[model samples]
Target: MRRGCPVVAEPLDTQSLDAAGPAPPISEADRSPARAPFDDLASDWRLRHLLDVDTLSRDEILRILSTANAMAEVLERPVARTPALRGVTVFNLFYEASTRTRSSFELAGKILGADVINVSGSGSSVEKGESLVETLNTLAAVGADAVVMRHPASGAPWLAARTIGGHIINAGDGQHAHPTQALLDAYILLREFGDLGGRRIVIVGDILHSRVARSNIWSLTKLGAEVTVVAPRPLLPVSMTAGAAEKEHPLSLPNVRVESDLDEAIVGADAVMALRIQGERLSGKLLPSSAEYARRYQLTAERVAQAAPHAIVMHPGPMNEGVEIAVDVAHSPESRIEAQVSAGLAVRMAVLFLLIRGGA
Candidate 1:
């Protein structure tokens, strides 16, 4: 129930759960190839299923990354179309409003050679009793093999993934995990730094409300990158993700440091990812103002320089310039904002290709 809290089908075995707070341990099952479950998907892009990160072990994570890296190659090619998912019918069932995520996913599906359709709740059957599951079922009946979904609820994708016959790829689910965003960000780092192991990276700004931050930490630290989370106490989640995945949380990483001091967090870091301050979730008397937050935690040039000179700046799409980062510097070459977007499509295409091909 991490993303907007989808109803869980079964109660978790709490006794077996690791008592550690948000960001649980990375299972050896999840470790990159050496593990067999995921190794098979490496060559088989037709691998279906985008249920939850919990189900796919670490090696699967690397398998998808390897698959996504290949998808990225498609983006670099002329016209960027592959028959991998050719003629596969797919659906974009977005219960939440989005501009870039929806567009990128639809573009990714089209590029990977799949038939795409978009559905929004604003003026659709969803206005009726059609639950998220109900609508998705209808899509499946109509021949959809995959769904790139964005919902206001956190665990919506997980619930839908189980409810539908087709595979589910979470676009942005509440403040919960955004797997593709995490994957693309990881891809950007992989392309830049080679391997994430031992690299120092800091994610500054709204950790609690930014799904990007949550998902990024899991992928980043898993590959051996050092992580740091800097945010105001109120803005950060009182409790982060729990259960077996605890080790992946940014705060739990052995080398990761949690600091309220923005400047200190960024100092000498290899990369700094600034998450847009989500004003919607801010409750009574929390943050002062956009201007105030910008002045304090905002990644202006001065604060960035306080960190290592080599540190690169990152942000997810539709950035709140004055709020989380300064407008002038957000577009710099070192800023992989757009690159992150491009990689998102490639990685998502990889996810879809796996699911659709398998389901087909």
Candidate 2:
């Protein structure tokens, strides 16, 4: 884990398993056209904070997707380094633990030649009675250009954004949102099917507490994908109607459907995204047992076969192998779990590039 200056007091021992290491050198073949597909959107994107996908416009979403596509091309080169954010400093201030997201952001910043720092609540002033606002202000005071943060509290990123002047990238904040994860998932699907318009995507497993599902619903719907969320009644939100008066419920976006029958949801689907059960966040009343959950909602090879012949499988990962997805299905040729991870790197790189340099 890369350490940064402590928030207020002494630094804590915040070593992470997903530390960013040295990237390979960029080769001549890695160079591509300098122009970005979403240059217009980039210029128009005045917001310095990336709080959620629900607030992003279709053109803005496409701009990030196009920028990610460009970054993917760079990754294929011998040297993947870019000086897009060479002098910028980025900090990962995670109040909650994450393997894929934290590592992805750290690596993205490093590959773009930015100074990346990792600060965790466990070993920082946050553990010593400091407030979130205080820590964010301290980071800004120390010259941070951007802050990628994850917190167990919902809307924590939004709160931080209101307190700080630097760019705020929400890694994950409770069940409210995981915007970048959604963008990368869309990137993978777009690469697979070329177009998302009119395609069906089934998101299975725990829905009530999944930040990934919330973000995916917003982004995928904007891209014109037909989204169906399948889960046991306990795991599904109480309401699925868009623009509901309740603010705490899961979003009811247009073109989205809620189903309890996992089998019924997968039929004719172009892609299936199996979300983890999120056992840690559960209240113990929503589920019976892991065995039962697996029997009812697990994405087995047989269930996958019920979908379109060319349908693909997806999982945001740290997969609860047998609980929500069968092991064979997760490792199947149609599975895009690994591809999502790769896409995350490029997507995050694009996000940092756009926020720091303002465009390609």
Candidate 3:
């Protein structure tokens, strides 16, 4: 058993992909087992800013995963504490509301022995009409080593990265990306399946406005997983399909497919991720009604039965209970939603550690 929870399955006997393939082996010196809790994948490959997964190399994603594995071990211990980032300081600058992302980042920094300061838009100078760049510059002036930010505007983190000297990590930015959430999600799936190659993952629901969906597409594809995004015509982005190639916007990626039918997309899939309908972000009428949306796209038990028997269920939460997923299915054993929350701590820890140390 791991951390008093039943061990999901036995460890895979086969070698990891990098070890089996022609890819260069990660050196022992890069592992840093003595100095840190996890195995660092590469020595020269440093990550300075984490604005989006769209630019992350396969090796960089693997490094974060491997380090997260070690951090998971620390989480399972009696007392989870590490001095990996003892002298570093992190600032959490959130212009939007959050619970899991905010708390986990703060906890991760604390566990790693970093001084973490949280400044939300409500009480901060942002309320006094201070510009984002001005607030970020002020934070940087106070010796912040890194800034984990969530803003209501797309490309906010990218703007901050270009403007600030400190490393910028995107917690979530408008409809652009939430890279670490995608990392933890991939981590959960990696633990369950050992490898993501050839796996079919069905992402169902509001794809048009979900930053989680955007980030997941980039990371999951990079890791060799086939993704099928399912949503109603209005809820799905126009750039998400092959037909959009002729248009200016291009959201489609290799190994990804867009489907309008939820049941068709879930059929024989390895995993099903149901996204919450973000009503707040919706500009105009996108769906007929909440009941209609639930009837068409919700992950009912019957819909889950259509997937592979071992297929997992996921949601990047603040779930709208009976809307995107059946309440029972959300609490079912096949659901990895809860585990994803626990994995967030480790994943965020690995991210902070890598960006602070390796990025240096």
Candidate 4:
């Protein structure tokens, strides 16, 4: 049976459902022009590559979100395919294993009529001793118009953008940034709460190793959201704290505050995002027993009630049910987790359309 979200039991599991869930039927309102202030169909998109959320300004971020709204309308249509990216050759170069991200990117590209090619590290020349630099250069040499890459290293996309001729979209780069995930997350919130300014957003979980948390910090703070990052002392990175210097943690803006108490931080939150525990990235025991961690951090139904009455629960999946988030909470009416995946498709389609065809 097709589930609502493609979230699997683990992030490394390659057998998850396709991230593009069934599209909602189009409505009369969906056919209308986007209501965002900026014109999403404009031909003035300037960024060549989406390497990080830090590179995007408030206006640019809004533009992308607005464009995604238009893309959503397309998704609801009888025939969801669009010719916006026709003749474009897009390459998904994933060094790390992924299910949601990889599947969504591929679906997004195909839906936009791009010639999508997927290349995994193990399946590609990287397994046969090809260097990252060589692999990136090779994709460029083969006429890739845009390359979506997920790597184990933090600044791999930046390196690829420098080395390759095509555009570099950071799928997820180690503990650095997952820009698109942040965008889709923001999209979900924007749809729920029109204005993010002065909104309280609580992020709970393994903050130290989560690229999702890092990316969310940049995007949410930029949009004037009051972001509270809650985690255990070990799981919380010193770089993301307010006490850290600007030069030390440039992306950790003034709107963000660190908290050790999930319940305390979640109070009056407009949204609560529980990040996945990045087990593969952990080394030398950053966490205690999983049971202990769950007791301290799991987003349960009771804790969800502590937030604002309309507060939405979010997760950048493959979720560890009963670990980072409780099973019922993941499927709760207030949970926007499934919608986040759907929004990812539209957001990615917008990204590719704007980058390749320069919008509608």
Candidate 5:
């Protein structure tokens, strides 16, 4: 069934079938010069490689999302499964505990017709001292075609991608990049604003430990969006990630900026993304207090409006509603947090299609 507006679920195993409306269909009239047929196609292809978000270029990213748009169509069909990835083996190997990301990756694989295997940290062989690389090799040895991984370490996705031959899609890594999250975020921006190019999008909260923030920064900027990172001084790292440095990412790409004041950052922005402050990452010196962080960095209704009238509010998931956002502000039509979740499935499906179908 087509589900919508992904929220942070804690192994509920129950799905909401009512959230999504049906997708637009590929029609003979859709052949009009304005429409891309793939945007309406109901079936999907398999993707093989998912090593890293950086592995995808702008054109590649567009194509992957277009494919995902089609996969979104399949959600409403009588039978959700297609032969797009029949017989393909995809493994969900997560060393860290996750709810939505893990479930969505599993859902994407199944919806695209790939056999799915979910391996969690608890049941996995980590207690035996088998390194991540060795565990990945074991999966490959058993005929795995792709590995979707979430590790506690940043850059683990890239390392796994290099270490393993199959597509290594990063679910989430330590304070590095969550490529799929970025793709979904970009898709939401694209779906709403048409193009993120030259648009000002501000991300507030914990930039220091957010993989979502890092990936979204890189992805949005590559698409020509003007991006800014706003947080207390404590939320930002002393340096950029290895991925950003490796690319020699010029400031002009996203016209990136860093600010200490959330109020100032929201002023004149087209969009504002509020990031969650992980309780786990907070240390002795990083924050004065959660209450203080809430007061200083939170996106209130007044703050959200401080941006351009066209600005939309966003969050990756598991929102500290009372903390990072006012409850009234989270459900505002301008907030695309739910849309981001929907787009996530579409984006992941696209990545899988591209890698498995090898860009049919």
Candidate 6:
């Protein structure tokens, strides 16, 4: 049975344990065997579910990234497969349509030797009036080791975790959190810059509706990166600008700056991420016009030139070409959009391996 408690142990005090004499000789059973790089990353891993980036500590985040570094090596091999999760089963329970995330998770699990199942809201029993909890319970009844879910409603993964015993990985939940996306984004950034401390990252486009923006704010800020989020006033979440008078919002965090001007925000940035406009999630007309938004906030080649010389360009995907980002900039030499996909695969592989097989 999976234990909810983390495996971390307190450091032993040999000086106090046997102060009168030398400590007892080390026991063979207590000695950890020599292991491959990052094999022990999850030796003390505690999380049973990865629902959001906000809950992950700096150490936990580092562990996942460090492990992903090892997984990247596995991906580089001729076969690009591993027996890490040889007998494990991972179910992708996506309630919303997905291309990058669903495919990435499926590939990650399969690459790790896990039995992966793909389920969609339209094709599943949900069409037959099955509930979210009911669907998760059904998966658990059939020996599902983990459920990576994406739903339109917020907090669906948390609900699934509470309803089932299997590990829960949130793919995305209605402008809530996409932990893996943030992880891969962070991984890509770390790979490029080595350290995020004092680095400037500007996120452009819809902030209120973009779950990627919310999660990125948490992940990047925790890593010591200064983040500036640019969006139209209506597209910006109230939580971010509520305390504008004080220049700090309780939910939005102090490290995050809300900017109305795209040109101003891009200056001196180490990386710039453009978010897809989430029209489906918008309740009403949030922008005056697409052209107006593009004129004001769209990431352009000239604007990118204003950032640091070595700055990288990024997007979470399903990019709106000429709408949110210019075509040339998306394919520019400084763009890490394609690299983010590769990093995502490695990061997901690490997450699946650590959750299901680590410390087993």
Best model number under TM-score: 3
State the lDDT of candidate 3 residue by residue for 222-278, as single tens digits.
888999888887877766654663222246477888788888889899999999887
RMSD of each: 10.8, 9.8, 4.8, 8.2, 8.1, 8.3
Residue-by-residue lDDT tens digits, candidate 5, 151-220: 9888787778777678777788887778888888877776666656678998888888888887887788
lDDT by residue (tens digit), candidate 6, 61-180: 767776676676667667777666777899999988999999999999998789999999997799999999889889999999999999999999999989988899999999889999
Best by lDDT: 3
Q: List runs of model 5 lying over 4 Å from the truth.
A: 1-48, 240-254, 280-283
Off by over 4 Å in 4: 1-40, 240-252, 280-284
Per-residue lDDT tens digits for candidate 4, residues 124-168, read: 799999999998888888899999999999998888988877888
Model 2 poorest 10 in a row by lDDT: 2-11
| Sort order, lDDT high to low | 3, 6, 4, 2, 5, 1
Model 2, span 166-267: residue lDDT tens: 889999999889999998888777766656779999998888888899999999998889888888877777665345532223453678888888888899
Pairs that clash in candidate 2: 12-123, 25-79, 26-79, 242-252
How does candidate 1 score on lDDT?
A: 0.69
Ranking by TM-score: 3, 6, 4, 2, 5, 1
Q: Residue 25 of candidate 1: its Cα lDDT?
A: 28
Error of 1 at 230 (Å): 0.5
Report clashes for each candidate as comma-separated counts. Answer: 22, 4, 0, 0, 13, 0
| Local distance difference test, each candidate | 0.69, 0.79, 0.81, 0.79, 0.73, 0.80
Where's the lowest-lDDT run of ten residues in candidate 6? 2-11
Task: Give the Cα error of residue 28 in candidate 6, in Å.
Answer: 20
